[model samples]
Target: MPKMIFVNLPVRDLAASTTLYLALGGTLNPQFSGEQSSSIMFSDAIGVMLLTHAHYGVFTKRPIGDARRDSQVLLALSVDSRDAVDATLARAVAAGGRADPNPAQDHGFMFSRSVEDPDGYVWEIMWMDPAAIAGTPETA
Candidate 1:
């Protein structure tokens, strides 16, 4: 297998986090997706490992900062269309999550929305039409 990246995110409640992602067009890898932590399969290689705070602490001896209080990381994913972004945020809201305050970044060619998961980690869902992107050298 080629090199892959897995974003490890700490959550107060693993079960809730799992459900939230599952609602947003994500699948679970039973091998790694379980009670304590789950491998949120976005595209096989690019997966989000949502581990409970207690479970995550086992790996990191340091205290886990509260994401709600402090921003530790920002998660972003590029999609094929703007509708995909709205769909994801809609599903997130239904799954007990909230969309961030920022409005969608629609620059004719590109569109994006930043949402805050229930646990407060930010995620950016964006769509860029290649033709539009190619035309805009600055966006390139």
Candidate 2:
């Protein structure tokens, strides 16, 4: 079976969120972008749902976590190379995201940089040398 991943993020303004995502090179899925939610297609099988807090509240009886002050989750996406990571992050910042206070880590085989989206959702974009990763038996 094919695999898919969905990441849902609560946003204060759906329209603004959608615009920022598009600016970051994310595509829109019309079937899910409407009065309630916007499905942003990042890749063939990866998508994010920008749901209003009230709409997202329906999914849980508990109150929504304050992503601006705190965080419900942090997401990380991988890229092809270190340059790709840098470029993607540049786009995000230009689109209104914040740079992580910490510096990037280059561990010979892997490189990672973190950034927070406009709503304060954290994302770590990393690039890895597949051969090095595979050779690192400890990772297994």
Candidate 3:
């Protein structure tokens, strides 16, 4: 079986966070979700577990850091094309996220933009030329 990744995030408002994820093209997984938490599946192998701050504390005794002011981690998502990256950012903004929290990156081979969710968690949406990843040049 292939390994899957489920990133756990602490959210201040579960409903709002779930809505933002849905707007960003995630599907809700009811089986793994509840009043205190939500499972948003981005792909078969990628998922985000949005946990209420109280519920999140159950897993760790450390206090939750304010994502808006302090940076602990920057989550990144790879999309198929540059347009997809822009679309994802747009959706995030429409759902109450702040766009371009970080400077946008635009190397010839890769492009990226960032969005900060209502709770201040940052997600970088990016795209890269497959040829560049494969260490090959594009052909005419």
| Global lDDT of each candidate | 0.82, 0.82, 0.93
- Comparison by TM-score, 1 against 2, better one: 1
Candidates 2 and 3: which is better by lDDT? 3
- Better structure of 1 and 3 per TM-score: 3
What's each prediction's clash count? 0, 0, 0
Give the winner by TM-score: 3
TM-score of each: 0.88, 0.85, 0.94
Off by over 4 Å in 2: 134-140
Model 1, 90-130: lDDT tens per residue?
98889978785567788878888977777888788888888
What pairs collide in candidate 1? none
lDDT of each residue in 33-88, candidate 3, tens digit only: 99999999999999999999999999999999998899989799888999999999
* Candidate 3 structure lDDT: 0.93
Residue pairs clashing in model 3 are none
